[model samples]
Target: MSSTTRILLGLALGAAAGLILAWFDPAHAARAVQFAQPIGRLWLNALQMTVVPLVLALVIIGVSAANDAAASGRTARRALVVFALLLSAGAAFAAIVAPLALSLLPRDPALIDSLRDAIPAQAAPAAVGFADWFTAIIPTNAIAAAAQSAMLPLVVFALFFGFALTRIDATRRERMVEFFQAIADTMIVIVQWVLWAAPLGVFALVLAVCASAGASVLSALGWYIALLCAMYLAVTLLLYPVAVVFGGTRLRRFAAAILPAQVVAASTQSSLASLPAMVESARDRLGQPRAVAALVLPMAVSLFRITSPMQYIGAASFVAWIYGIEVPAAQLAAAAALAVVVSLGSVGLPGQVSFMATTMPVTAAMGLPVAPLGLLLAVDTIPDVFATVGNVSADLTASSVVARAEGSSEPAAPA
Candidate 1:
């Protein structure tokens, strides 16, 4: 069987096994989940270990080999515009649709109260200002940023370092580009080795999640969970047609291409972990040029999180609907704007923490209770899988669109 098929099978079997265990023996299942957590973490660490070096090398080589600074800047601007539009659409859809869908669901105050009680309180960080957001992108210490997996700062440093090569002697520049290319090629090999364990890793990860959270946790927040899943599914489904119609990608081709990356994203719940798969898929399956894949995918991972706006806006809207808070049109607009800014700014943070930090201010702005966030976080795991899939799909779609626009109609020869 193909690796993608194996990964899918692992997901199904692991979830089934976990659910059965949870149904039969909650205590033992919890213990099993505890044991599996470390295995899953180890797998995730193995993937993350490649992210810094891989991303840095990709950015450096892509920039250094660009046709010209002006052309590269135009490509970057086009990518950003596409990213912003997609984010806005997601946020708007969630803001408009979630509240209406949530209203139709049967309200259960008792269940909501119980869920809130079960979740421990977490203090939200102070809101990030525009200055702090922009400043954080530039690394004060590149080494420290890499060590911490600070993606935005590391990307910024890589861009500067890559551009600096263009100003040097031609021979030296070519040598440096070749060196980074070698590093990138090496990291891609390491990523492939890591992904060979994907089925096992995905199984462990999914098993841990299902065993620990169980059906009971989901039962308590059924409506909320259902709404988020529905929204994520809708957005994910919509992306395909958009890619096909506008980006000239075939649906089957796109789906098959992105499957491995989507699976990794679903299992690991970290787009950074799935970056290698995305880059590979874009180059090999989607037929994007090397420069476009390298340039677009890394930047997309760092800046263009399409799911963030949807998730944050959906969570906030759900909270408002549950509490009978009337968020005016103006407030919803403000929330959408905030969602875009936060989604763009919260690069490199853990998915959940970033969601909370970015959404908290919008919640406060809309006059909704912040306590419900803990409950949202509690049930966010399953929904996160779909969200990650959406993000990875968008990464590939964006790459294809950008590549086509840049006139790289044919895929570059694989490195």
Candidate 2:
């Protein structure tokens, strides 16, 4: 069968499986939904398998390659400038969207109880202040941090290694680059082979989410969905487009260039899983410079699940409001700051929501109930589409800005 045919089959089977299980026994439906978990898990594991090696490879390659693209100092400065602008824009966007989502939904006393009941027992402790934030970033041990998959520390370590690789003599650096490139190439091959199963994996992931959620979850949270739609529109239509324009890209061309990454990201509900494709799409189809696409896209996945953080900000504020806690001006500003900082550690992996959960210091500080996290669990997949789209858009925008300013001789593939 053609790829499109296989995708159709997966979608059809997933939908039928979900509905059949729901009709026969809603409780059993959840069991059926479990089928998707392993597929999704395997897919995520494959992506993560390459994280350390790929980051090491790309950053080393990026720094080494930067020397050839332009003056090393200028290239580094320009990339940082683009990255910083994107980060600031993302934080501002979250701050604006949070207040809007809160204003649209009235507080429900019952929701707090229902949400509390739905929460798993091993809930994260409420974060209190700067100390709690500082403690979260400090891993007990470096090896343990890498072993336990602590993202913030892993990034810290990788950046140090990448920078070190750049300081080596050219011949030695080139040899090191060749070795790491082989590893990256091997990982890329594995990533592509696994991607053949992507449509099925995506269907399984989405179907499981729909089947497992209570029938009333959607109906009861109608206003929340409206808020989500508003958030999506603002991000998709306004914030991302403005970023693209500011970065010297035309709207129509930018959309065309980024659509594939958006589609894969939307369907997979993961920016990390979507990374290999995003890299290829941006390089081959979007005509982004190789160094720009390779460097910015991966970094963007780690730093930008744009819509998810926005959702969390909304949830944080709503939880505070419903529980009769006034989020002080200082606290709100702090949350805004933390949201941006925490995003640097957000890999586009399955536990991303959990990472956002960890980022909620302001909510915890204000004595807000974390129960509203349950409400977010229901709609996570839905809003992921927008988040992933924003992620890809930011990468492309950064790529364009960097390319233009650097006058990198590479032209992205024609849209």
Candidate 3:
């Protein structure tokens, strides 16, 4: 089957499973659904098994390449600056859209009251202080950090190893790079095989979630989904075009070229999973160099995740409002800055919730009431889909800027 055919098949099967599971009452399929939970767990494990190594390899390669380009003349500096600007714009757009969407949403006083009641009130963090931020990154045990998938420490370790490789003898550095590359390749092969079965896995996972929780969680969440879609649309239509113009790329062409991948990302709800399609699109349609596309796209998948922060921002804001906690403007700014730190400091798959758990000072300072993360946990699927699409789209746009700055012979084309 064609790639499109496969994607459609997966989507259809996954949707079928979700609908069936949603319709399943505990009285009807308690034992069978209970039995199916472990299968979903196993599937999650398959994806997670690749998480650390995939992140380490991709980060090492990206920084190494970025460092090389940075060490070059003015052109490379310009490219790096443009890429940074694009990232900033995407993140800022997400943050702005959250508040704007909140404004547009019809405040359901009754539903809000019910949700507020459901949420246990807790004391806000004592202060927006630095101690909490400092303590989050410096884990006592490397193993414990890895077990918890502490993103900052993991990123620190990967950066340390990559840069350290640069300073060593050329022959040994090559050997070390090759060693990591080999491991990365092996893991990618494993991921490919598992992805072949992902349709079943995705279906089972959705089934488990629906069966256990029921649709009540999302019945009143239509507004949340709409808010996320608006945010996604803002990033794509407004921020990205501005980025393209600023970066000296042809804005119309860039968006056109990347539409296929963006659509796929929306369906898959995973930037990491969409890497192959993004890379292919960048190389073939966008005319990016294979070397640049290969190195940057994977790194962007693992490291340059802006959307997770956006999700966290939206979740945090909603939860704060639900709890009647006043988040001052200063706190929102602090939250945005912290969002960047938490995103960069995180490891594992892009869009994973654990990263937020690890990076947010609020998660630590606020207790169990904050623990539920109820707002996001309710509408994760909808937001995750939109965010993943935006994340990959932004990455592709940055790649175009980078390619142009590198002075590649390929003329600027519409993406």
Local distance difference test, per candidate? 0.70, 0.56, 0.57
Candidate 3 lDDT over 310-348, as tens digits, reads 655666655554444555444555456545544543435
List, in order, the clash count of every candidate structure: 0, 3, 11
* Model 3: how far residue 352 lies from native, Å: 4.8
TM-score of each: 0.58, 0.54, 0.58
Q: Of the pair 1 and 3, which is ahead by lDDT?
A: 1
Q: Ten residues in a row with the worst lDDT in model 2?
A: 115-124
List residue ranges in candidate 1 displaced over 4 A. Answer: 1-72, 109-220, 411-415
Q: Give candidate 2 misplaced runs (Cα > 4 Å).
A: 1-77, 108-222, 284-286, 352-359, 412-415
- Spell out the clash pairs found in candidate 1: none
lDDT winner: 1
Off by over 4 Å in 3: 1-83, 108-117, 124-220, 350-369, 411-415
Error of 1 at 98 (Å): 0.6
Which pairs clash (backbone N, Cα, C closer than 3 Å) in model 2?
287-412, 287-413, 288-412
lDDT of 2 by residue, 1-415 (tens): 7544554566556556665677889778766666666665555455455544544344445444444433535655576567656666655676666665565566655544433333212233344475655565545576775565454444455556556877779788778878876775665566556546756664564456446543333344455556666766576666456646565667776677677877887787666778888787767765667877776666556544555456556667655544435565445555665454444433433443242234333344334544344334334444556666666666666666766676663566553
